[model samples]
Target: MGTAQAAQAAQTTQTAQTAQAAQTTQSAQAPQTANAADPGMEQAPIAYVGGMPPVMDHMIYSHALLDEFEARADGHGGQFRYDGQAWFGTDYDKLWLKSEGTVGTDGRFGDGDHEALYDHAISRYFDVQSGVRVDLDNGPTRAWGAVGVEGLALYFFQLEATTYFSDRGAAARLQGSYDLLLTNRLILQPQVEMNVYSTNDRARGNGRGLSDIDTGLRLRYEWHRKIAPYLGVTYTSSFDQAASMARTRGRQVHALTVTAGLRLWF
Candidate 1:
């Protein structure tokens, strides 16, 4: 009777152990089953849909630069000069307005060049510009159709070359400048400009072929990125018949001047 009782007790213990093992396995599988059946438990899909951010590449912008506004002393007298430009548009296309000129102590203004141009980007660092240029001052006003290319050259030199045509004659101009940093806020700049003509305009003191050249070196201290004060020396001269015309009018063919100016941009 004792042996039968012990065997029945062992069988009961075995049945309980089997039932607990089954319960544990079912508990482990319950979560997986729920995840498969419940739609909220699924991971969200990655896809490009209607809700996305906009790009700024097509946005418009504008800028203006007053490169030089200076007073010059050439021993004989004092003169005032100005060079500036403004542009409005997007990254690829723009409208450019440029003006530069000189005013003499004798209250005479000359060499005034103003332009309204359409600029198109053709390469990474260059632009092609086409438009009208008006020569206005104390002399006879002349109008011309102008085309030009301007950009950074090799070694980061700023350069511009433009040609003009009108009923009076054909003309071309080349301008270049370079900046050498002396310090974080100090710089030295060298600039040059040359003009040529196909016909003479005696009334305007212009001659055929190579007409005039202007070159200068300036040292500036930048109080701010948008403004600077500079001091420089400039040499301006006429060549060939232009020199003769200048001499005939009792004007110096060549003059060296000291300049003090401000450079501004925004």
Candidate 2:
């Protein structure tokens, strides 16, 4: 009976040892089993990512207009007008549209001009742009190819220079403006625009040389960045044959007037 009891105890010990060895082997092989089951587990740290979004695309569809509304002198009579440009897109590329015209008291939209442009940033402060321009009234419905540059100069001044070309001829326009901040919300802006031509278009009453110039000084108080009311003084003058054409139409070649209007953006 003593021998039989010793043999039974040894058998129990061997069975326990076998169970412990099986558990040890499973622990060592568990990670290898998982890696074989999922091939991605081995390559998870080095998987490639492709086709990312454009670096500049995160800022989309921001738009603004620096000058949008006004009333000005045309002759002994006068006209209300809105001249504005708006742009939208990412910082690197954008679409631009500009429109201006007189709203006649006689219920006509006269002297209308419109342009559509694509703007590409070439430097930190400037863009190169190209587009089409259409003169809607006062001239034949003429379309021209336009190329231009618009930018900040000397940090505080805004400037634009553009040339237009069509079968009739080529013309150029230059514009500049500076803002004087009287306070956080009060601003004084002095703006100037000049137009020149390469040939005469009698139907449109445009001259071949320096044709006309407009200069204005405006003071505005902005309740917000999106809106402002302004009062200003403006002077417009014609030169060379352009002046003669104005005289022939009995229109004032040079006029000074007061302008009161709003500047708005969204």
Candidate 3:
């Protein structure tokens, strides 16, 4: 009876040990099961250690345009005319050069206007410019201090308004243009310019008050974005005292001319 009781006690102890071992195994596997069900809890967040990349605003650039390089034929004779501009700088600031003039059939140049300006962007579509203007041609030469505003107006009209101060007198100019696209590669443009002066300058053929106005309509075909050929008609007229002065000199008060030209840009 005593041996039988001892054997039963040993078996009871073995059963208790097996149960403890099974409990320990379940505790170890519980955490691994939870991690497998929710893997995101074990992941580390990403960090940005490197700096940002560069931007293009700091770079410099340049552009040139020959807006008008045309030959004009009037009733009296034929003449050549040119207007061009170039600029160098960043997007916000630039140095600009502009020139325009007419060459007579006799090979004499007249009415040459040249300007060098500093331009600053004042708005998304506008700029404020201050500069010097020099009239250099076969006749008398004049210099002026110039200030102007140039921009795209309502509905994308290009506009410029400038005032000039000089020893001879004060002068003002207004210029505007609009492009009407007729097709993907064809465009029609209308342009106008007016000049006004405060004093008479017989040497330069300018008179007090409203001096002159020039208007043109042109049709251009763009074979490439940088090159276009155009045909146009231009009307120029003297006004107020300018007309009287021109008539006294036996010059025509007005002229209507046909033109052929090329427009180029780079």
Report how far residue 43 has shifted in candidate 1, in Å: 17
- Output the TM-score of candidate 2: 0.77
lDDT of 1 at 152: 99
lDDT of candidate 1 over 1-266, digit per residue (tens): 69999999999999999999999999999999999999998899765456665566569999999988999997788789999999999878999999999988888898899999999999999999999999999989999999999999999999999999999879999999999999988999999999999999998899999999999999999989999999999999999999999999998899999999999999
lDDT pick, better of 2 and 3? 3
lDDT of 3: 0.93
lDDT of 2 by residue, 124-144 (tens): 899999999999975578889
lDDT of 2: 0.87
Ranking 2 against 3 by TM-score, winner: 3
As a TM-score, model 3 comes out at 0.80
Look at candidate 1 and tell me the lDDT of residue 31.
92
Give the per-residue Cα lDDT of candidate 3 at 167: 83
Model 3 lDDT tens row, 1-266:
69999999999999999999999999999999998889687777565457555567668999999999999998798889999999999888999898999998889999899999999999999999999999999988899999998899999999999999988779999999999999988999999999999999987789898899989999999999899999999999999788988899888789999999999999
lDDT for residue 236 in candidate 3, whole number 0-100: 91
By TM-score, rank the candidates, best first: 1, 3, 2
- Model 2 residue 252 CA deviation (Å) reads 0.8
TM-score list, all predictions: 0.80, 0.77, 0.80
